[model samples]
Target: MTGPLAGIRIVELAGIGPAPFACMMLADHGAEVIRIERPGAKKGGPGGDPTKDILQRSRKTIAVDLKSAAGIGVVHNLVASADGFVEGFRPGVTERLGLGPETLLKVTPRLVYGRMTGWGQEGPYAQAAGHDINYIALAGALHAFGRAGDKPTPPINMVGDFGGGAMMLAFGMVSALLHARTTGQGQVIDCAMTDGTALLMSMIWSFQGQGLWRDERGVNLLDSGAHFYDTYVCADGTYVSIGAIEPQFYAVLREKSGLSAEPAFDRQMDPRGWPELKEKLSAVFATRTRDEWCAILEHTDACFAPVLSMAEAPAHPHNVARGTFVELGGVVQPMPAPRYSVTPTVAPRMANEQSDTEALLDGLGYAPDEIAALKAAGAVA
Candidate 1:
């Protein structure tokens, strides 16, 4: 944990969904994130293996049964020593758990409290149970995907879960942390996945208002509307993506593919002619294997690329050159993102599960007898 946020300490109340995802991002960026997991919590939730969870990488874990007053006291103690805290419970759940903002903020006056939810802290659906698809469905993101004539396609929870959910929580927490540092004040960040997803759809909303986009799915400029801006299946059953948006880039694509003599694409921006041009381009692209098209246009600014699978992305030249992925604990996964120039980050140490529990408690100023009692009661794992 040695990056731009080298010294920031975060206390995370472990739960599911966006909470762990948010804390993971924080831990990745060099924050000292200490996760408080449930006593009997299991591994392999949404993110990954609890032991090998890349998202939970680089964080210290303390298991506590919140049903006990001592467990809640442990969280407050951690908060007193931390700069911030993040939780993903429903609106009143934290208050019921005796760790609400009002109580914790009194203990750690300068703490930034980040709260993540699907419907938000107070709303009609605030207490309802829903997943990423349900949240983004109301936000118009899901409605904008899929083929033109087909129903909307769910993008596998990435938009709402990771983008709107985890990413938004991270952004809000950082903002609150900055404010806390400067104003000597702490505030609660109410990060709602629904709101975040809706915010992400603003650009498409603008395009729709201007008549540049259609309400129908997959017919907008970036949503497979234009032939050059969509994925095309190659002769080898694999697919490649193209994005020759600008006229110059489109010209490069034509010249490289030996289609400059074709008149179908003479007028690029005419919506009336887009259908015919797309048909012609599709035909031309489908003739070659994905690799052949990559050889012709991948390196150029024709804005073309092969639609690499999950396994292929880490091996590509660009990803390899950028060191975009790292292998740890016999697993190859994406590296922590948003690299810093001055403070470099590293992968977390994988000691035995909860191996440092007693030592960590000892270091945190907990008395030896109290720690032994916690273990004796099976409240701490």
Candidate 2:
């Protein structure tokens, strides 16, 4: 339990996607994360099966019926002993559940309250229900991510849910946590997916301002507008992504891929040459299977790599060398990210949910008989 965040305690309200992932990442890096689950809701149940939801990877899961006064009180008790709390829900739901910041912060004045929502707590659409796609669409992220002539393809919710939602919420919470530790004052983090996604587009907006990019999708330098920056389907129908933006890297890509020392490729940044250069690169790349290309160009200055699937990515040579993935509960899952050399990360043991309701209560200064009474009342599960 003693690593980078040895004394930090975070209580997460049971939810989906980014909330759990942020907690898992936090737990992986040595935060004491206690996930508050609804009573009888099976742990790790999101992967359509309780055992397969690997993202629900860490933390002590305690099912509490928030509708019960005892259960609501339990959260307040936990908050009092916690440095932060993370919850992902539509705006107004937590306040309606009586666990709102206004109420809980009164109990724990120095607790950092982290709220994750698609539209944030005060926006007009804050109360509306939405998923990753809806949030991305509102952020102009969906519009900026497609082929010139093709409909925008969703990027597997990485842009919205995990990147914008969970990660941003975690960041805000941690920032507030650091602040509270120094000043003994708590704050609320209002993390919105729309806001986070827009933040992700800052560089893209810069390109647009210089007229270097089109408002339309896939016509920008990094948005597959240039042939040198796109994926090429090889002979075996697998893809090799090439992103040699610099002239030095592009030169390496051209020479190794056997592209002639042609005028078009030589002029690496010419917008008029993108289509033709892309076509030429496509033809050449098609001559080799992905494997063949990797053998030739991977790890070189070409900035090329075989676009491996999730199953294939774990077993990749470089990734395996780095121990980027680990097998857990009979599933191959990604290892805890952002490593620490001195204070190492540890995998959560057993996928087990262990919270001595009495012990947890005792940590919050509750007596044995008080915890027993709450359990007898069917409040804590």
Candidate 2 runs further than 4 Å off: 48-50, 353-359, 365-369
- Per-prediction count of colliding residue pairs? 0, 0
User: lDDT tens string, model 2, 1-381?
Assistant: 646877789999988888887888778778888888787675665544545676666676666789998899888878878888889988878999998888878988898999888898886898899999999999998998889999988998999999988888878877898999899988889999999999988988898899877899777789899888999999999999989999899889888987756766787788888888888888998998999999999779999888999889998989999999888668888887778878888665435554445567677787888878888888885
Question: On residues 171-272, what C-alpha lDDT tens digit does candidate 1 reach at each position?
Answer: 988888888889989988898999999989988889888988878876667888787788888889999888898999989988987889988778777767
Cα error, candidate 1, residue 381 (Å): 2.3
Clashing pairs in 2: none
**Judged by TM-score, which candidate is best?**
1
For candidate 1, give the lDDT of residue 209.
85
Worst lDDT 10-window in candidate 1: 347-356
**Model 1 whole-model lDDT (C-alpha atoms):** 0.83
lDDT of 2 at 340: 83
